[model samples]
Target: MTEILLPSDPEVRDRCARSMASKAFLTVWEGAVRSGKTVWALCAFALYATRSPDGDFLLSARTTATAETNCITGDYGLLSLFPGAEYRTVGNVRMVRFRTRQGEKRIHVVGASDIRSYMVIRGATFGGWLADEVNMHDRRFVSEALNRTAMSHDRRHMWTLNPDDPGHWIYSEYIDRYEAMDAGERAELGGFAHFWFRPSDNPAMTPAMLASLSRQYPEGTPFHTRYVLGMRCVAEGRVYPFFGPSCVAEPPEGVRAEFASIDFGSVHPTAMGWYGRSPDGAWWKVAEWGPTAEESARMTVADYMDVFERETERLGGIRRDRLTIDYGGGGEALVREAERRRWYPVNPDKSVLDGIQATAMVLSSGALRVSPSCRRTIDELSSYHWREGRGETVPDKVRDDFADETRYAVSTFIEPRIRRRRRWSRT
Candidate 1:
């Protein structure tokens, strides 16, 4: 068998070379877009296939669309690397077969959008597995793919991705885990080897390409981070992109109006925010109760009502006429409980998107103030994000619980007050 030399892109070639040489259970090649991470991972597998007889490998992406578009294992460029090899796509293009000097190599491509599809191949085995854009795939896919090869102690699982948000599972788990190992603070995951590079290392990137990228994407945007500097970006499903450490602000003294917005939950969390009206006619968030999970069994309607009452009192004062909450489900019963306790429990506005827009408007106008005490709310506001890849700034529904509730509360009460204040000033 002849050794196939990779392309002239040293960064891509080096990443491929590194993966080929690694002995760890997990070989990770992470970098920014256009840094040649994908090409390198595929090339390394191709080289391995030619050297190892009947080598069985797996190629996986977040979606079939991605698997087709990226064209890693089944594509021509990857196949072209191996000279005089017969390549064929089988089983609806899920698997790729190659007949070569080293023997027969099978590459299977799997698309996982949800956890159920990942469960199908639970007990399967493989020689190697390549997870592309790992940040985009479901976390369960990672667990399943890695475990499937558990029986093969020598099997290598490779992951390639760009930097993602701090909240992302990959960053928090894989990247952070590797960093801890390097710092001698943690034990390394057996057979795990991770490497990272960026677009700045790519000698193939020309000045014209940089200029074109600049023209195509806005400065400080995800495209700039992922493709230009090769930085990790926040996941697509985050809601509070604006919630971060930099946006912290002090709450004002002597509130004129105070209300609490409660979001009831059991598995997700039962969240609440205490708000106050400041002297400057701005709405200030004083505190929050959020992202909390039930430690034991499902929280009963009685338990939620109890928590709501406690949070309301902690906020200073909750007038029976001002307290609001998300509508539907057990909201009415909770409202009844609030009424019994002499705390207002009106239904908040229901539109998630409208509430998001309403809160954004308040923040943009500098009318929204967040107290240092409202750590969770503040964090949610800063870190909540959207899928920029689809060309929009809308918040992701999955992680926008607090933001949605804020919007609903603001739309129900604060928006009207702000509108009235604006109208009064004009008059």
Candidate 2:
């Protein structure tokens, strides 16, 4: 095994100790992003695997790719804890084989994203399970996964995740119930232990890093409250609360790249935005266009294409690969038409919350700005809000065409560049 240098932070050390000592049926480390909870859980699981009963163990995340990245091959992942660990595939299942003090152990890695993913473990049994980002998994998959380990002599499960809505099934069904139970009650129902982690709990986070992360998710925003403080809160109020006068500016010269994004609609108004990225990595929304209700009602794919061409030419003709469009509703037809025209239009990532979060972070950091002439886009930015009275956190869809288009542009084009820049800076 490689030499491991543990941090000296008392709280972090205590959490690590608790993880290794936990005898509960379910051990959960829930908290903020970069809180080191996943590392702690993985370390604990590594210890458990050595002495665990002779049965298959499972390691899972929201997707198989994420499971492999975060658990098996990540910097502080399971394989890193075991020097000779190697991944192998048995049929459709992926497993990590490693020798421990007792004997060789095999742990299967799986994705628990889809509700139907439970079928993967339907007939299989596991001695224990380690699930990263468990809250993102479907409730059906989670329930079934826990049942898969019920027959094992050492039936333990470790889960780590960032905070979500208070009403999320993971919170209400497990965390809340575990917290509300008395000691006697908890003991009778099989032990459950929950550990809360904050960004400060991560020893690797320097003061400068914490300050930078804090600036990305400003205070008084849902992203800050949930991701920074590790609180279970629903997104409310304006989606782009930081999009004030400062976020509205004229386009800069010497642009490095330009792109356009569209939110297509036939009944509703179609919205399109032309965006440019400056050399310093800031994004500027240069122009926006939308058809009136009457025009949208009568417009065919060809008409829309004509308008797109005119707008593209007017805004200095963006490359075909830079075009992003929503792939739902009438947007699908628009994408096909763009392809037929020899333009390779890409579909934007439609994960609403993730896109919204990325957009908000850039806007808050002043890395994203919109032209004052794009009046409709600016209006949507200020008025976009979370839907109220909904059990889940959902952005209200009213008058959000321009907002969706902006999100598509920023998330599809700007976010990836921002991530690349950050990684480069780190290196």
Candidate 3:
């Protein structure tokens, strides 16, 4: 590791000034992975930390170790960037105390992870705040940090993170303010300005880094969009970050059992998917069929059942015990129909967020594969998202039945133990 020299790039220099001078309560740096965002963010915080600083300041991340490793300990670390700073530990917490021409300054290191995360820094009134990988933090903790920072006359914040889903709160809460400010509709900076960084912006990044990224994420993947182009796009926010051609394959011959997953919708398409699980604990979507919203309106319950039976038989032999259908939407008719066929009513793990995470876990590990013949399922997997204020992982309510059914399959089979985990796995 080498000392980080602040960039002399004119655009970077200009943006740094704009960010520091802005009146916004929060300034955000978002872009490609391994962009110089962390260094840029530290620069902004350093300025706030020492320039006539008042009250305590905060430097936080998703965890305390990350904040220390990323900013405080490395060669270009915060202590190195500002050599005169004094470091000490108070009780369980670590702090950096420094001097400004106007006064003394302190930056307390904290970690923000969940709803109760604000407790770590609850009593401190910070003049400034900075958090790395801000997207991984709970929104409540972020809000609390901002609220606490109001104590300072020179209130500033530097929140940094890799580009994430378009629906992510950072875009709505911080990035959007920059947009409104740019459009000349706002008189003030609104305590929000965002600087985007691409990997190429960092002089240290070599051609080898680009090649490794291409090999890991490839073009046309969500990872490429967020990490390579550094664009905050719709695809970046997908629930399944790794569903694509690479995961499409024929069902393996080691198939132990076959099951059908279905989502019922009278106004929406009723999606039925066949999945084959390998004895080694892998799964593949062997086939999928669903009716369009228009066709569903004309079809009677009996007609729908007939279609389901025919599709089931077409995919070979799927036993009644192996069929699962979502209990939401217009599922009553489907449930009744399934009962007539002597099949069990499918009641899956109803926690929508857990289900989405479970699906992502499977897809990311390459444990779940989709057959090319299951085109609709493949398309839905690529597009399902977490939108509407971060809690809900919903689709646009159209062309999503297959995705919903897959969620059932995922919640039921992929992480049948989600009840124990209770939240998305950070690992």
Clashes of each: 23, 0, 4
lDDT of 1 by residue, 127-237 (tens): 777787777777787778877776653566777887656566677766667665753333335555677766544555667765654443334445445555666664354
What count of clashes does model 2 give? 0
| Global local distance difference test of model 3 | 0.73
Model 3 misplaced stretches (Cα beyond 4 Å): 1-3, 6-13, 16-24, 84-88, 99-103, 181-191, 235-427
Measured by lDDT, the strongest candidate is: 2
RMSD of 1: 13.7
- Model 1: lDDT equals 0.65
Model 1 misplacement above 4 A: 1-16, 73-76, 83-93, 182-190, 233-427
Instruction: Provide the RMSD of all predictions against the true structure, rounded to 1 decimal.
Output: 13.7, 1.8, 9.6
- Each candidate structure's TM-score, on Cα atoms with residue i matched to residue i, is 0.51, 0.95, 0.56
What is the Cα-based TM-score of model 1?
Answer: 0.51
Pairs that clash in candidate 3: 24-191, 24-192, 25-191, 165-237
Please identify which of the two predictions, 1 or 3, would achieve the higher lDDT against the true structure.
3
Compute the lDDT of residue 285 as modeled in candidate 3: 82
Ranking by lDDT: 2, 3, 1
Candidate 2 local accuracy as lDDT?
0.85
